[model samples]
Target: MCTAAEWDDFRATGTRRPVNFDADGFVHLSTRDQVHLPANRLFGGREDVVLLHLDPARLGAEIRWEPGVPTDPDSMLFPHLYGLLPADAVVAVTPYLPGPDGLFGTPPLP
Candidate 1:
């Protein structure tokens, strides 16, 4: 997922990041069922966020499943894309702003 501005940038550029890719050397991804975990943990109260719905098979990167956040036993091995994100992989994009309580809920499937 990306921030609202990042999504805009992706739309404009047509090619997206390899960005932090996480320090583990890839772009971190959360499954549809577990996306809220990372949303609350990482973005928390942030408001300018957006959820990017992507097609796994279309990603140009090498997507790997591995232990992303070690301390969190709930979601240890998450999907990580080991190269740049291509615009073709992004099937949909939606605003993912948090609620008034400053907690984020999962984005609805497109």
Candidate 2:
């Protein structure tokens, strides 16, 4: 997920390198079923958050499935892209607002 401003920048540039990409060496991605996990952890209570729905085949980069943070379920794996995220790869973009409790739940399906 990214902030609304970040999404606008991504559209203008046609690509995006997440803030942590340099340190992590890959762009973090979460499946539809698991997006809420990280959204809540990192962006909870933030109304500006937006979810970028991507088409995997259009990514034009190598994707690796790796274990998530320690707090996640033991068997869960997340997708990481080794290159910048091209804007064309995003099939949809949706606001990811947190609930009144200040926590994110599963986002609406694209």
Candidate 3:
């Protein structure tokens, strides 16, 4: 539930760091690329539980968010990495899975 003002605040921080949540629920700042790759693969393809904060503008690109049925495990390909994203952050979503032939085709923004 991130509000526009809250998003503004985050951006105003003048930092492009990845926020980390520890096992104790404590949050800290880290580099965006510091996020582990395995975590990124975890959420490669998902349908249920709309993930917020997938900003195309931030990505400086256009993409599409095609919702698919949630698969088993209910986890993202790179859960740890993708989970670090802000709950309300907007991303350029593409309905594609990882591995060979990733992201089938280019996703155009709406």
Candidate 4:
């Protein structure tokens, strides 16, 4: 688990994205901004959430997003976990792996 101080450090960096931890103990940082949707689908739209796993070392990050739920009616879409994250939630630090573009690398889904 990450300590409060570490979490604060991540937030202080001013980065707005979820960090992820891989099964191999690597960390990945997301380079994208918050997802956006149509005006009528901001809150009550289908659930589109990002999934992040944290490394025990606190030195890396990994990031993933769940497919949007068709039943959601929100205009803007941000990756999030349904019923898991709060409205004002932000994940600053996470485990990541180096990618070809110098960002976290994502493996092909099976």
| Order of models, best TM-score first | 2, 1, 3, 4
Could you tell me how far off, in angstroms, the CA of residue 82 lies in candidate 2 after the best superposition? 1.1
Tell me which of candidates 1 and 3 scores higher on TM-score.
1
How would you encode candidate 4's per-residue C-alpha lDDT over 11-104 as one tens digit per residue?
5764323343222232222223322221123322222223233232432232344434465444534343222222124533233233343332
Q: Give the TM-score of candidate 1.
A: 0.82
- How does residue 75 of candidate 1 score in lDDT? 48
Model 1 clashing-pair count:
1
Using TM-score as the measure, the top candidate is: 2
Each model's lDDT:
0.78, 0.93, 0.31, 0.32
Evaluated against the true structure, the overall lDDT of model 2 is: 0.93
Model 1 regions more than 4 Å off:
74-76
Error of 3 at 83 (Å): 9.3
Cα RMSD (angstroms) for every candidate in the order listed: 2.1, 0.9, 12.7, 14.2
TM-score each candidate. Answer: 0.82, 0.95, 0.24, 0.20
lDDT of 3 by residue, 1-110 (tens): 12234445555763223433454232221122322232233433332211123443343322332222254234332112323334334442223233343322222232
**Cα lDDT of model 1 by residue, 1-110, tens digit:** 76788888888998776456555576778887667778888889898887888898898778888774655575467887887778888888777877889987766776
Error of 3 at 97 (Å): 27
